[model samples]
Target: MNAQPLLEVRDLHLSVRAPNGNRAPVLRGVDLSLARGQVLGLVGESGGGKTMVGKAILGVLPDGARVERGSILFDGKDVLAMPGSARRMLSGKSMSMILQNPMTALNPVMRIEDQITDVLRLHMRMDKAAARERALEMLDAVQIRDPRRVLRQYPHELSGGMCQRVVIAIAFACNPALIVADEPTTALDVTVQHQVLRLIRDLQMKSQTCVLFVTHDLGVVAKVCDAVSVIFAGRIIESGPVREVFEAPRHRYTRALLEAAPRYDRPETALHPISPALREELTQEIVHTYRIPGHAV
Candidate 1:
């Protein structure tokens, strides 16, 4: 309890410029915190403002979306209040992000070696040989069997899973204190998704890094998150320990989301219509959002 939070979003309010140039609030007084080595899952439909919060933390907002109000503190320092130079220095060294799409995060022209080495050079200032060595070591740590081959290959040369592993390698290379993984397993096949999720969990535990895992899948959240925050219509309506929230959901939207999720052992049948109340909530404000321009192939 005495340890300072790795990251906190206090009473955050975000807004986007509409076509008429009026500000429409996208995030409504969000409050979230994560300590070192903790994982907090943010689960909701696509326009619930989960990604907006993550982007605000990263200082990378989509078009017209701005953090109009709030404080984003990281390890007792206010990130949104920091000067540009300090923020740049702190980002790669103390905080890192793994996007959902591997292809978009990686550069097709640059070899994986250069991509990771650039991070090392910018953050750690390692020599050429040392940086390359570190890059290979990270590739191996992320379970890439042929580390040298991966290092030499361009992003387009690798399979989707391999490219995603490369992204994971970059994110973990600096042993960052906080990592925001936004839908990291999206678009992968079921088998690959399980493998990648396991890898992320193992790495998070081993590195003692706090994670803000933003995903739409409740099953994924159940497997990875120690705590759960259910957001709807740009507001966090419910939050608690994952088990508590799952066992006794207090919010109507959370209940509807749980109801819509399929059960494995139960017989397959027509999905019960999600309650009109929740459906209205989801579609009323924002229908959907795409955080990444082009997701992984």
Candidate 2:
């Protein structure tokens, strides 16, 4: 028998309160799985529920959002069924998130040393001295220079790339089993983005951790992900090994997304955006599949 997946999401249907007091579906029966030490990419356009999937797994959905049905299982335990305290205990210790914006992710007023050490202290129960030492080690692991100096500085004192590195360091401080990286490289330039990607991949390999890398960039997925899932209108329409799916996409939407991305080999080629008719078809399909009246697409 195959070993159980590290993470499994099944028939997850979530909704948020709309302005008019109606619930709008955000995740429509979305299902996916991630094995230990694997990097799975969740790629889709804006407002396609990519980030929502990550949020649901982490149990950090917005205030107005609710999981109407389905389950999220981490390490064979039902995360959605766990109590608040149980979920909180699992969060920083076994599962952590690396958000899109490092500036907002890190507390501006706190020193870098305190930020990293706090998680180590809380999760690992390290004493003050031990936490401090481990914090420095975490910084060095992320390729930060002059770790001691950086420890004394605040978020504002570091460059954007450095701040992101610090955030990454914090996320990995507890050696969590799973990480949900939501567009972690979107805020950086090309060179910095590549470096951050490499750093994340290296650290993941060393730790043997699973990652749910959520991004709209196919290029980033191609570089870092072992498997790929294509989500559209809150549904996973296609998924498979990266090489197989990229070379021969079975879904029309998947083909459209691949075509939409820019090619390095053919720099002269113009981009082709997804057409409106396809979007409408997908929207209708979602409505038909769920058969729920007044379900927002």
Candidate 3:
């Protein structure tokens, strides 16, 4: 695996504008780096700025959110400094995102074939016929048995797993250098989730694609990520190799999250939530650090 970073986000601070015009901080000095062909997992509670990081990198921050201070570098190019055309060109073709809900991410009106071929047509500049053929090939690569019939089907006609497979096909169609998968399997059942995860891992390894997988599922992170970063309230509290972090978590939140996850072998182990004191201390640390000028957020 390449040691050089394909994507780097340093000291990123983002805020969402409230209805009253107040800028509420969302991501406070978020720092993340993903090397070529690496799988980096961003694990955190809901609303912990995991997805926001992905959105910021993809240059698709939701309305009312803006980056206050930070630098997002992709392949040594400054994403924040890029021209509008260049940024738009780089977004989907080189950096893509697999949203949490495929149903919402994909167009309900478009057929599966059209959806998958669109990326190839737009980015790869392939002719429609060639793009369609390549789309079929990609569908096959994603393990769809009857790619022909499925191509003609609409998103609503397919099962959740199948729809997600189509979404993956679209995401990987352009062979993006970096993929932000925001809980791609969150809506699927356990069996389907395992299959989807395996399929993603297989494709990622085959393409040597760098991926930043955002999820609250530690089990998924353990299975798929090369490195793991634990985020709490918008800050990365612990990060290292997956095995190292999982085997011995250094942060209270990380430890608590691990202990809280369900373990089949330990059926009697009750889930332990993080204590209120620990939460308070973590919040205090964030506040104190941010208050100190020149301190890393």
Candidate 4:
């Protein structure tokens, strides 16, 4: 690991306003660090506050959600403390995000070329012609054939895989220092998933870009991650290099995840869910540890 990481989230706490005038805690004291030129996998079950961590980092928390405490530091600068104008400038320039759903993330009314070129023009200050050329180059880099044709089309006209490729193009277009890839391949088929994963890895290697790869799939984590963090009940229970954690997971929750995941090599292996008792115990511990005053857990 590098002595200085490209991105770091320390003691992060977030809450969402419920329908009945209540705030429910989502993330509790979550800490993560991504070293420069490395992919750090955040593996956990769904609804475990994994996606919220990424949103918090980008300062894009959803409606009724707010950051209660903690700091998001990118390149040793405190993003949480930055002024609104400065933070807006920092987004998509020094830091960018590849959302899970490409079509929803993109504008339905805009053409693909216009969408991509907008980023280049806004951040790089390139002229329209130059931005268009670079956008085409990026599409080609992501292995999109007939880049000209695709550029003219909207998100609805392209396949899910192609849309994902375009999203990746936009994310890497500016060569941002850090990328938050929140399950970018979850919607694609196995073949497309493989290709997208390969594209991300190749781009990261070529540019030395740091990535926070968020997913529940352990198999994908093993394939592309340099280091892995196991998040359970909004807490990071265990984290280390991929090989070390996979071979010898310290936390029982981590071991449970590995046991539950389907393995192609072990065709007859039975999948076992983590014990309910253990899950309840962990949940209670989190509730107890992060209990806020005047707020029900």
The TM-score between candidate 4 and the true structure equals 0.96
Decreasing lDDT order of the candidates: 2, 4, 3, 1
Candidate 2, residues 1-297: lDDT per residue as tens digits? 348999999999999999998898888999999987899999999998999999999989898999988999998999988989999899758999999899999999999999999889999999999999999999999999999999999999999999999999999999999999999999998899999999999999999889999999999999999999999989999989899999999999999999999876678888999999999988898867873455755
Off by over 4 Å in 3: 264-268, 291-297
lDDT of 1 by residue, 1-297 (tens): 548878888878788888877777778778887867789999998877888988888877888887767799888888888998888778768878988899999999999999999998888889999999999899988899989988889999988888899999999998888888999999687889999999999999998888999998888988898898988767777888899998999987888887787754454744555677657755564324412122110
Tens digit per residue, CA lDDT, model 3, 29-58: 888989898999999888789999999999
Pick by TM-score: 1 or 3, better one: 3
What is each predicted model's overall lDDT from 0 to 1?
0.84, 0.92, 0.89, 0.91
The candidate that wins on lDDT is: 2
Q: How accurate is candidate 3 locally (lDDT)?
A: 0.89
TM-score of each: 0.91, 0.97, 0.95, 0.96
Give the clashing pairs for model 3: none
Taking the tens digit of each residue's C-alpha lDDT, what string does model 4 give over 1-297? 568988889988889998898999888889998888999999999989999998888878899998888898988998999998899888759888888889888899999999999999999999999999999999999999999999999999999999999999999999898899999899889999999999999999999999999999998898899999999877889989999998999988899999988876677999998888988898998888876677768
Model 4 clash number: 0
Instruction: Give the TM-score comparing model 2 with the true structure, all chains together.
Output: 0.97
Q: On a 0 to 100 scale, what is the lDDT of residue 53 in model 1?
A: 87
Off by over 4 Å in 2: 291-297
Model 4 clash pairs? none
